[model samples]
Target: MGRIPGRLPFFLETFAQSSIKSHGSRIHPERFNSTSNKVPDMKAHQTREVIFSGIQPTGVPHIGNYVGALQNWIRLQELKKEGKKEMDLYYSIVGLHAITLPRDPLQLKKERFEMMCVLLAIGLDPAHCCLFNQDQVPAHSEMAWILNCIAPVGRLNRMTTWKSQIASSKNSNSLSEVDDSMLHLGLLAYPVLQSADILLYKSTQVPVGEDQIQHLELTKVLAKALNKQTKNKNLFPLPQGIYTRQSKILNLRNPTMKMSKSNPSDLTKILITDTPEEIRKKIKSAVTDSIESIRYDPENRPGISNLIDIYQSISGQELEQVQRRFQDKSVVDLKSELIELLIEHFRPFNAEFSRLVNSREDVEKIYLAGSQKAAAVANLTLSQVKKHIGLD
Candidate 1:
C-alpha cells in the first residue's frame, strides 16, 4: 500500500510484468498502423482508426479526469477491439503543455512519472495504446513551430483557456497571482503546439473533456489551412473529438468552477488514489444547499447535482434514476453512499497503482519504448510536411 517514488523494487517489477501481460499486447505500429495498410483481406488504401489524446502530468489523476476522459479512452479501445478495422492509439503525458505555466524541474519530473502510473493503474492496456511523454520527442516542437506560422494570432487570443489565464484564474493555476502582463509567449501560443501534437500523427479521433472542445476546433481549423497549401489534400485527417460525457465534473468546493488540480482547496477535487477516509471527508464536506430534497437542477443546486452526476457517471445509472434514489434520503445519506461507491470503485486499482509507482525504472522503460514508437510516426508525418512546405 506504500508508494516509493524513487526506484523500482524487485517484487514490484515481477508483479508489474505479470499484471501487464493480461492487460494487452505491445503496440506493434506496423500491425495496427504504420504507413502500410496491407492485410490478409483488406485493401491497401483502407483507413485505420488513429486515436490521439493526452493529459498533463498532474501526478495522480482526479476522479474528474477518470470519469470524463480516462475511462472513455479505455472504453474506446474495447469498442475498437470488436471492430473490423485495426486501431492505433496514442496517449501522452503532455509535458510541453504542462510548461505553458511555470513548473519546478524536480517536481515536474516526479509528477510526469506519477501520471504514467495513474494511466497504467486505471487499466490503459499498454499494448493497445502507445503511452509517451510528449516532451521526449523532438518532432512535437518542430511541428509546433510549423503550425505556429499558419495559426492565426486572433484565434489564439480568443481561446478560453488563455482568457482564464488572463482573468487570474485559480481553477487552472491559482497558486500564483497572474495577469495578462505576466503571461509569456508560450502560454499564449501553446494551443498551436496542441495542434501540432494532433496533426503530427494525423490522429483520426481525439478523446477529450468538454473544456478541450475549443482547442480541438482550433486543431481542425489549422489542419484545413495546411491542407489548402498542400497538393496532397488529405495529409491530415482533421481529427474528430469523441466526447464521452454530457458535462464536466465541477469542483466539490465550488460548483461554479471545473474540478482542477490547481484549485487551492484540496477538497475541491477527489483523486483516484484517495483513501476511504479522504473520500468520506471530502464528500461529507462537499458544498451543497440545505434544500432537504435532491433534484437534477444545476442552476439552483449545483452541489447536489454535481454529486448526482458523479453517482450517475460511476454507477452507470440515469440522472433520473439517481435523483429518484436520493430524493427521499437526506444529503448525509447521499454522501455516505457516494463515499462507499468511490472506495469500492477504486479499490481494484489501489494496490496496482502503489506497485507501479514503486517500480519506477520499469515505468520509465515502458514510456521510453512508447516514445520511440511515437517518434516513428512523428518522423513520417514531419517528412511529408517538410516535402510540402519546402523545408525538406
Candidate 2:
C-alpha cells in the first residue's frame, strides 16, 4: 500500500466509526468482591479487553526497545488481526513522563513526533491501535491528580525506583544516606500517574518491563481502593501485566546494565533506524569474552551471553537451539552473522521510517486522530469516576 496522505484517510476514519458502533454499549459489573467473586450477569463484562501502554519520548528507540517491547506489541496486533484475541489497544508517547527529568523542550517536541513515526513504521496501524501523545489528552493529568489524592505517601516512599534515583543522584550506596529533599513530587508520585494512565481508559492489560511491575501492582491497589471507596463493584478493572518474553535488553558495552538512552556511549545500543554501517560498527565492537568458543553462560561470560541472547531473541529461536548452533563457531563469526541479521530485519522498517519522517504532517494527523479515539474511551471512564467521587 502507498503511504497515507496528510489527513486521516477515509478508510481509517470509517474503521474507527465502525469500531465505535460495534462497542457503543457500556455495561457495568455489579456485586463487589473484596476477596473473590462470581461472574457478573451483565453482557458488558464480555467487552473487548483493553490493552494500554506508554513509552517515554527520550529519543529514537533502540534495538533493546524493539526486542523487549515493540516486537511484542506487533505480535499482539497480529493476534488481534487474526481473530486470536479481541482487544482495544492504546499506545501513548508519554511526553509528560519525559519531563519528570530535565529535558530541552524543543528537543522533546521533535522527539515526540519522531516517536509517533517510529511506531507507525513498526507496523502499528492507526486503525488497529490508538497511538497518541499523553500531553495531547488533558484528561491524563486530570485523572492523575484525582488518583494522587488517594495514593498513600508511605507506599510512594517504599517505591524502589524513587529511592534508587535518589541514591544515584547522591552517589550513595545506602538508601538512607540519600536525602529526601532531593526527590521531586512528580518522581515520587509517578506510580500514581501511571495508574491514572492505565485506569483512565479502563485498561484491562498493560505491557510493561519487569522493572515496572511494582508500579502496575500499585495500579491494582488503586483500582481496588477506588472500587471500595465508590461502592462500585466494577468501576475499573485491575489492569493485569502482559510481560514480554525478553523484558530487558542489556547494553552492548556493559552487559550488566540495561540498555538506555542515558548511556553516554552511542555504540552501547542499536537504534531502529541505524544505518547498515552503524549496525556493523556497533555489533563489531560489542563486548565479548576472551574465550574463542561461543557459549551461553551468563554467570561467567555475560558479554558473550548477552550477544547470544540478542541473536536468539531477534531470530525467534530457542536459546538452547542458538547455543548449539553456535557452539563450534568463533566469536568473530557470531558477530558477523548478528550484524547481517539485524540489517536484514530492519531494512523494510528503515524505509518506512524514512517515508514517515519526510511526511511529518501525516504523522501528526495520525497522532491527533488517535488522541481523539483515546479520549472517547477515556472521557467515558472519567465521567463515571467523577460521578462516583461527587466531582460531576
In order, candidate lDDTs are 0.75, 0.76
Best by lDDT: 2
Worst 10 residues of 2 by lDDT: 27-36
Task: Name model 2 segments beyond 4 Å from true.
Answer: 1-46, 164-179
Q: After superposition, how far is residue 282 of candidate 1 from its true place, in Å?
A: 0.6
lDDT of 2 by residue, 135-246 (tens): 9888899899989989999988888887765564443435777667777899888888889999987888887766688899899999999999899968888877775455
Candidate 2, residue 261: Cα displacement in angstroms equals: 0.9
Clashes of each: 1, 0
C-alpha TM-scores of all predictions: 0.85, 0.86
Query: Could you give candidate 1's per-residue lDDT for residues 1-392 as a string of tens digits?
Result: 01222333222222211222233233222333342221112122126767788888856788887776777666655554546336777889999988887788899999999998887777675566778889999999999999889989988877767656544344443423545676789988988998899988888878755557788889999999889878667888888766553356889988977787776688998998899889989999999997887777888889988998888777767577887898899888998899998888777677678887888777777788788878878887898899999999
Query: Candidate 1, after superposition: displacement of residue 294 in Å?
Result: 1.6
CA RMSD for every model? 9.1, 11.2
